[model samples]
Target: MKKINLYITLKQGVLDPQGKAVQESLHTLGYTAVKQARVGKYMELIVEDDANVEQQIEEMCTKLLANPVIEDYTYIVEEGIVQ
Candidate 1:
């Protein structure tokens, strides 16, 4: 089995209103040191180890897991991480 960790985030130049809101709230709470804040999605997936697994994962990200035009996604596949 393989353990997959997926991270999804907004593409550069895209508006991140949620992140901006967090930053503004932090600043209000006197967290002046924070220059920016980003909110992202993290997903953990367990899949059978097979030759087509990598391709399947790529398709999953591009087709459904993330928005290809506005959001970018990256994933890490680890061996022996799932039981």
Candidate 2:
């Protein structure tokens, strides 16, 4: 088995309204040190270990998990980790 930890985030110039809202709220609550905030998605998947798994996962990310036009992603694969 294998473990996939994927992180998805907006492109550098993309607007992040959710993150902006969170930052504004934080500042209201006296957390004024934050200069900027960005929201992102994190996903974990466990799949059968195989030679094609990484490619399959990349396909999934591009097709459904992330928006290629505005988002970028990275993943880490772990071996022998089922716990």
Candidate 3:
């Protein structure tokens, strides 16, 4: 098996309201040192190993996992053993 870890984040110059809100909230909670924060998505998938796993995951990310217009995605594939 293969474990696919995907991370999706907004591209630079895109406004991240959720991250801003979290930062502000942290400041209110006395974490004034918090300067900047950006929120992103992480997803994990377990799939049967294949010769084209990388290509398949890339296509999945582009087609559904991330928005190409404002977000970018990267992934890592690791070998996983299933007993």
Clashes of each: 0, 0, 0
- Which pairs of residues collide in model 3? none
Error of 2 at 51 (Å): 1.1
TM-scores, each model vs. reference: 0.93, 0.95, 0.95
lDDT of 1 by residue, 4-36 (tens): 999999999999999999999999999999999
Name the regions of candidate 3 deviating beyond 4 angstroms.
Answer: none
Candidate 2's residue-wise lDDT over 1-83, tens digit each?
99999999999999999999999999999999998999999999988879999899899999999999999999999989766
lDDT per residue (tens digit) for residues 50-79 in model 3: 999999998998899999999999888889
Instruction: Kindly report which residue stretches of model 1 are placed more than 4 angstroms away from their true locations once superposed.
Output: none
Residue-pair clash count for candidate 2: 0
Residue 19 error for model 1, in Å? 0.3
Q: 36 in model 1: Cα distance from truth in Å?
A: 0.8
User: Which structure among the candidates has the greatest lDDT?
Assistant: 2
Decoy 3 TM-score against native: 0.95
Candidate 1 vs 3: which has more lDDT:
3
